[model samples]
Target: MKKTIALLIITLMVSPVYALEALSDDALQNVEGQAGADLSLKLSINHKLENDKYVFDNGTGAVCADVQFCRLAVSVNNRFIDNNGQASSGDGYKLWLVFKGIQGTINIQKLGLDGMDLSYKDDGGADKIKAAMQLSFDATKPIEIRNFGFNALAFGQDKFLTTAGVEAGSTNASDYGYLQVTRYDTSNAPGSVYDHGRETGFMGVQMNGNLALQGKVMMFGCDASHPRC
Candidate 1:
């Protein structure tokens, strides 16, 4: 028995082992494969009214006291150049596009990444792979947006700036600013004074539905080869 165990140990110690190495370009071209991936996502941005104020749940069993609702704000800077090829003083201004009170649940059952393909193009007498990623999405599951809404759309200059410099662009009376469209009291006669003392906002929208989409989106790099790149 001892001799048998010793023989087995010697065989294992002398056995040859192979290490993995990267495949060459020629070898990689010969390899053919196909695969897909599935994704499930659920997003929610909601708020509740309490004590005449709006509050949001922070997902940790506590209310977010600092701000209300899920907000997205984008600011664009416009600069004007003078005849001397320099930026003119006080000629530059900023425009704000704010979407407030975003409340919705975006549920995607199965977002599929079907496959990827490589496209080749001729460039300067040589064949080269295009600098792009071509992907396809399967339409097996439809995307759902439930109770999606926003309280206001603020688009204008910096009139929404508060005393503390924080942006106040919501429909609230205290934070109301320029270029806001609100609901007016049209219940009275048309000739009577239209009461514009309701809410303040540029626009508001609420929608609920399932969107069916299935297609391929190609993301590519910008270069001189393509005129519209």
Candidate 2:
């Protein structure tokens, strides 16, 4: 009995399953965002990113998506504001879009505007990139982007991903959205200020303003290239 008990203990100690179970609680906690600011996160499950049909709306105001995937669009506007209710105009703000829960492999064919142009030719199966709010997983952090846009983000599964958009409201608060925002104030930093989201598999951040953003805590997993999804 003593020998059998020792053998069982040794077997459990060397198991990969045991190693996964040994992950620290803090490791899990690392995925959750801080408690101070309100964070809006959306993650889709089983969806693939497409580059040809996705579009940026530019806030031109014309029921923009008058068409379907052939002309689907999302309007984005940005500007700066100070602590004392002042709006800083002139190509004012930066916009970022977040993608979470991308399993398998993600190939970003286009990175929409604000300083980073999406191009599959450039990334070529690169695991991760952080150009704007789009967390391609490169650089491990989001880069502040200005003057770039995208047509669409293509993925394999449509139902597996969630998207979260954050409009930092005045006073350091934030607003969350899934599909779109009807009307938001772009005046004197007194409106929805910051915007961003998270993907379960990864998260990205881009600082267009000097708002001092922080790291995002996330919960995500991935399936390696294999026969069984």
Candidate 3:
């Protein structure tokens, strides 16, 4: 009985060792991933990010423009993760869009901007980025862009240079029509003012062609009277 017991124990340990080897030698798997869709974000650039607080609606006491300043800064913050486990971790995705005031005005019937599609999988630890149609911009690095431009048509033949533009007054904050322009005043304030000079009008962006993105943004308030929006 003792010898039988001893032989059984040996077999149990040795057999597991072989099983471990088999698991290690197992074939590699073809991990298939799901494709991504075209995602969009439409930002309603409303208020001025001031040093004191956000100023909106025909700004006064400092930052003010045609009714108030119309230019602003927008961005997308994200991170991209690569596959390979502990060996290689991941990467980061960040981008910024700065708007400069406009000069001459011109209406665009349609403007098609290109974008990147990201494919990924939940690889247990973190989301792995299988592939990306276009690469993401690195937030940490400073990428210089030249001849970056945008413009709009205000009345008829009047032209305006700008970083970005939108129609005024949409309950949601962004409109798809109407064009804006530029002119900087020395009068200084901490940030961009909204609805200062005049009440905000609908930014009729769709007729010209949807900036291709639309959604309501939750700011403390808006480029209007209410700040807690």
Candidate 4:
């Protein structure tokens, strides 16, 4: 019996033991939950004029010679209605909001995202819970945007109209569309010449700033519950 007991004790000491146990409420309360994650983002945009054309580089060694830059065009109020509420014109007549030649370096450090509850006033003036995404950043680290600029903010019937009167669907160099404002460069100027060292565009915006932003973007349904959905 003593030999058998000694052998079992040796086996128990060498082998691994597995067991399941229930935690008390207080113990569970003391347990720590998983913390969220952190994020860092950086964007570098560069552009230059080569042979009367604009070339782009996105921090990489490769250069884009095909007039490839960030461009966003939105058409608003494209549908025209007659007095009888009928369609009047085709999809040609559109007021375009174009943003072209976006070049800059954006740096954001330690941007945090987490789940949070948001409260807002309902349509009946009662406080309610609105779904939201919590966006938080380190106060010590501001969101930095350096050399931020765009070529144009044009408003016209077509998004592809050039200063040379070349309409849309033309496979010309001016096919990138007419810009109400352009960058301060010779390629944007008349006859490829700088206008007395002045920007030829309607407006020139050179933005470099460090912005501090921390908030929750609330999102909810556009139903009877939300007044300003």
Task: Please give the CA lDDT of all the candidate structures.
Answer: 0.55, 0.30, 0.30, 0.55
Estimate the TM-score of every prediction. Answer: 0.45, 0.14, 0.18, 0.44
Per residue, candidate 3 scores C-alpha lDDT tens digits across 4-33 of: 999999988888443343311112123334
Q: List model 2 lDDT by residue over 161-224, tens digit each.
A: 1222333333311222222222223442534353222112122322121112333322233233
Regarding lDDT, does 1 or 3 come out ahead? 1
Candidate 4 lDDT tens digits, 5-27: 99999999999988999865335
The weakest ten consecutive residues by lDDT in model 2 span: 154-163
Off by more than 4 A, model 4: 1-32, 45-64, 68-70, 77-97, 114-134, 155-200, 213-229
The top-ranked prediction according to TM-score is 1
lDDT of 1 by residue, 25-94 (tens): 3455566667656778888667544584434443565432222335556754443333444553334223
Ranking by lDDT: 4, 1, 3, 2
* Residue 26, model 3, lDDT: 15
TM-score of 1: 0.45
Clash total of candidate 1: 1
